[model samples]
Target: MLDANLKSQLKAYLERVTQPIEIVASLDDGAKSQELLGLLRDIQGLSSLITLRDDGTDARKPSFSLNRPGADISLRFAGIPLGHEFTSLVLALLQVGGHPSKESPDTLAQIAALQGNFVFETYFSLSCQNCPDVVQALNLMAVLNPNVKHVAIDGALFQEEVDARQVMAVPSVYLNGEPFGQGRMGVEEILAKVDASASTRQAEKLNAQAPFDVLVIGGGPAGAAAAIYAARKGIRTGVAAERFGGQVLDTLAIENFISVKETEGPKLASALEEHVKQYDVDIMNLQRAEQLIPGRDGALHEVRFAGGASLKAKALIIATGARWREMNVPGEQKYRNHGVAYCPHCDGPLFKGKRVAVIGGGNSGVEAAIDLAGIVSHVTLLEFDSKLRADAVLQRKLGSLPNVTVITEALTTEVTGDGRKVNGLSYKDRQSGDTRHIELEGIFVQIGLLPNSDWLKGAIELSPRGEVMVDARGETDLPGIFAAGDVTTTPYKQIIIAMGEGAKASLAAFDHLIRTSAPE
Candidate 1:
């Protein structure tokens, strides 16, 4: 299944493998398992130092072992390492095969300093490109610290564990059976999380009487930019969110941002956090805003969460972003992070030289098809509308691609996949009244955006589509409140645009604070 060029690349990459690495695949012979076995066999055959062993001597189920040379450190993959998960497999092989870690020496020292028998159980999926980074980071940490143990579980293979933990996101990391974080985390952020998990004071209530000059909600690029701007002005700033990075964490490649030739979502997110931390901003990570309560005395507003934690501020900037709209077709969720993926930039490379289909004919869908066409073997663009809604320029660009086949007025009914991954899509022609099936290895859905403003339903005035309305300065309908990013009435939801809006809102909030005198 490997292309000649890709095969050659893998062969050259594996030449640096100094010691033999053993791969133990104890699969139950499922459809996905067979596919993964073939991939492993191909990889093993390419490298002289690589060995594929099925001793069945290990007592674990659906287990894979990568043993380090001259060390008892053995990293395990308890799932099929396909899709984006392939990166983690390669990282594990190289790490155990005696390759030097890319992490800094100081960072390695800090990791080694963490003395605990903490079991890091990371739930991941193959299609998630971010999960591999987290898994490999933990694997590197384990290699550095003898006390730390890391386990990578394929959430799809272990549905029961995922269900028990109520894991809704990929790359969900649990430190000693408690939620550490989700998504691709930066090294410093993960270290801080590890320290926080070990700290006992996290349960203690923070000072509620402390009022902030400005409070920023949401942690994506917008909120981070907002907090950074507020802090630069020497104001008491606080930014709260479920996790830093917002929807950006779920994205793969981000090349559109000017000056940044190329960057990943997780990397940008971590950098945002790092930049915000450079200032004296009071950041509340893992905080989900529940209710927007009007502030009393000194503070103008207070936001409550499910855990009874509340924060008060003189002004607020709402940056809670939007999420990808799912097609909600059969096998869509079941095969997510398997063969069905939502991120074209993140998971596109995984489907390189493979046939794929894109659902939706809007700008996002067409753009995604265009992006995937350059990486994949062929792209079949299916649109439910009679005519494509994408811009004429985008349509022209998509048309110029010979490998792309555009099908309009196609009503997608189901995503057909074996128990493991998506193999084809079933759709019906709107005018012809004929059903059609297209064989594909991956599917990308780029329907539309659904703003994450449902939580502010009764608290503030929102547009009909649940987008928070804002004026020129990112000021919302309510005074002392502003919004930015995908959650607001911004014509387009772009990172650079959101960051600019966030800075504008923060400056406006500063103006409000200076004029009000109430915070004084």
Candidate 2:
């Protein structure tokens, strides 16, 4: 189950366990059960304080629980926790064994104060990059609060429950036996939903902060760079984002980053956040920007959030970034996370042996088709153009796949589904002007991205496609205001490009601040 190097690492990690822990396994005479037993024995060998038992009685065939003898911590795994979930397993063990967490003190307090009987069941896939955050957060809650108990189940292992619940996506969470959410969610977002007053309290805290010299509106690569640059200038800097990692959190592979040979999106995002924390920048996550109030006659610019809180800054850098472009066809929104998904790498495992469709024939779409062909039974690639727009290498790789079929000049018309989940989709043949429908269990939309500049529409200068228009210095038409990254009119929207743009915008903002005086 674990290799030599992996065993060495696990042994080192288990040394942090301050308390005794028990691993109770519930197994059967199946091959997977035996495999799980082998894994458990390997884990038990790593730590002397850890004991294994086999008198377990879980309904799931191959499952286990990590529990502290006298504590309220109750964490369970329904399948082998490997791949992206491997870190989750390690963190759960450390947390359940009384090791300290890296979460902020405020967040810890929030979890400790939570009241009520909350039972959480999260269905996840091993290949999902977004699942670890959800799983780790919930497991922490279970370890912290006695009222909270979480069971992270592998959706691929338990196909019966997935079909019964019609769970067509990864990180599908259920609270109290009802569907709670179906996407990448962090601790703050989860607390906002479970605790009624969490948002109001957060809004109040944000509203009371002092004004900053530079304020960034996003927390992606651009926002992190801008914040660091501004803070390094010995000025007060602040960053408020809906989520710290932004769209990069949803990305799977990132080989285009110059220095790094190969890396994952979440890993890069974490590094960015950690780098920014070394400075004096005030980092605020899970804050969505709503309205923008430009300063008049050297006044401070104020950015309002959806939570009814606003922050003022001498200069503003808008790096809100972009999100996955959605298919606005009928039934698409209704069946989202039911049968329609955006991140193939995150949700692909849930559709094993199932027929799915990939909309678009670009690099992202074609790449998605190739990746899904291995997990899913068949993949239908549809392109609105006459030919695939992917690179020759990618197109060649996509062509060689036996389980994938490509269609040209096909327009996705509407998503078809029953009341619960998607069943098929309708498309139009551009040449014949005839509509066609294909039955599939899932749909992965990989068209492109849309700029997150909708809120700056009437407040700032924007291009026809909603991208913020900026000059070489990353400054907008309005003085004391700058924009960067994918939200701006940059030629190419790459992560490296975004960071460079963010640094430029921050420096430009600092220059503007030095030249102007704030109104009294």
Candidate 3:
């Protein structure tokens, strides 16, 4: 099933196998089963340490398990894992063959120390870019902890199972047959949920760290740039982020980044992290900044975290970034993941052949409508403005799609749901003040982003819209404190602009540090 070039790459990767591994396939006399078998055979031929077996009896035919002989690991895939999941399959092979994981030592320890028996089943679609992270995380956990078992199921292939479970979203995870979560989650996020004391322990550890010369509060493009620039100055630099990559992780396509012709969000985010790691920057992931306490009376600046930990630094650069804006109407939050979604690229496949609505007329909205038109049966795009704000090229592409209908001067009012899932939504005609509702199986919100500056409301000078007010030097109203990226009043919310602002903020903070008196 793999091309010759792919086989060559797989063979090179299989060279890292340090232990005997088996691909146990549970197949039936079907085309899909044959395809899966062929893929497994190709993988098995890549290395001598790997073997294939088809004499398995799994309830789900065409399923397979990756196991190390005599090991208690339980990792299985209920369908042929291709598309974005192909990476998950490759990682599973390498990890099951005794390759060490790249996760933090503390995270690995936490997984290994878990005591309870946990069985996880994640429903995913082939086209979903966010599903691989969840699938690979659970697979790694299963390999690390014998008590943990994970089975990644393709929702598209197993439609009956998806419908029975009411899985209307990608990366819908279940623990012990109960809904656990439905979204893009990494290993740290998953561990924080499973291990209740993890946050407390992490907070305690963070509280004991020494003060940094420059501390970055986010891990998006801006934060990564600030961390790298500060670290390169031969000073102690640290980055505390809720989730490394921030809103960029949720972004799909990024074509405007300079130098790079085209790239995906996750790939660019990974590159940013890797580049930051090349320096002496200390990255603290999964740490949310709750409150910012500016330095006063020669005291160091302290940033409190939601987990009850606080970090102190001489100067702080806030790049907390922004999150997807919600319609904030009735039943919107109630039916989230059930019928309401913000990411068209991630959740579009789940609503294949179903009617959906795209909110907004900007570039994101137009792009989402264009992308979803091919997957969904029909798309109704609603814009609050009189005219679409997207580029002419995008508007032309959206207009050419027969399955999409664009409606201007439309204001979303309420999301209508059938108690369990969304059935439709109500909107108001801005021009005529007439109320209308459209029947749709899903609603993708692409309005815009809301700055994550709510916590800084009373701490700093904020604009009317809650964005941090900063000068050209990226310096905020408070001395020795700066803000960058979408969280600030920076004009455009672009990745390149964010990085440049971050670098400027870092330089400004460094200059402030050397020019002013040291902390007492």
Best by TM-score: 2
Candidate 3: residue 450 Cα off by (Å): 0.7
Selected candidate, larger TM-score, 1 vs 2: 2
Flag regions of model 3 displaced more than 4 Å.
Answer: none
lDDT of 2 at 373: 99
Q: What lDDT would each prediction earn against the true structure? A: 0.80, 0.94, 0.93
- Residue 230 lDDT in candidate 3: 93
- Tens digit of per-residue lDDT, candidate 3, span 1-520: 9999999998999999999998899999999999999999999889999989999999998899999999999999999999889999999999999999999898899999999989999999887878888999999999999999999999878888987887888889999999999888999999999999988888999999999999999999999999998998999999999988888888777888989989888888889999999999889988888898888865799999988989999999999999999998999999999999988888888888999999999999999999999999999999999999999999999999999999999999999988889999999999999999999999999999999998787899999988999999999988889999999999999999999999999999999989876463
- Model 1 Cα lDDT, one tens digit per residue, 249-284: 876679898999998787798799899989998877
Error of 3 at 438 (Å): 0.8
Per-residue lDDT over 1-520 for candidate 2, one digit per residue giving the tens place of the 0 to 100 score: 8999999999999999999999999999999899999999999999988999987999997999999998877789999998999999999999989899999999999999999999999999999999999999999999999999999999999999989999888899999999999888999899999999998998899999998889999999999999999999999999999999898999899999998999999999999999999999899888899899999888989999998898998899999999999989999999999999998998999899999999989999999999999999999999999999999999999989999999999999999998899999999999999999999999999999999988897999999989999999999999999999999999888999999999999999999989987763
How many residue pairs clash in all the candidates, one count each? 2, 0, 0
Error of 2 at 292 (Å): 0.3
Supply candidate 3's per-residue lDDT for 48: 95
Using lDDT as the measure, which candidate wins? 2
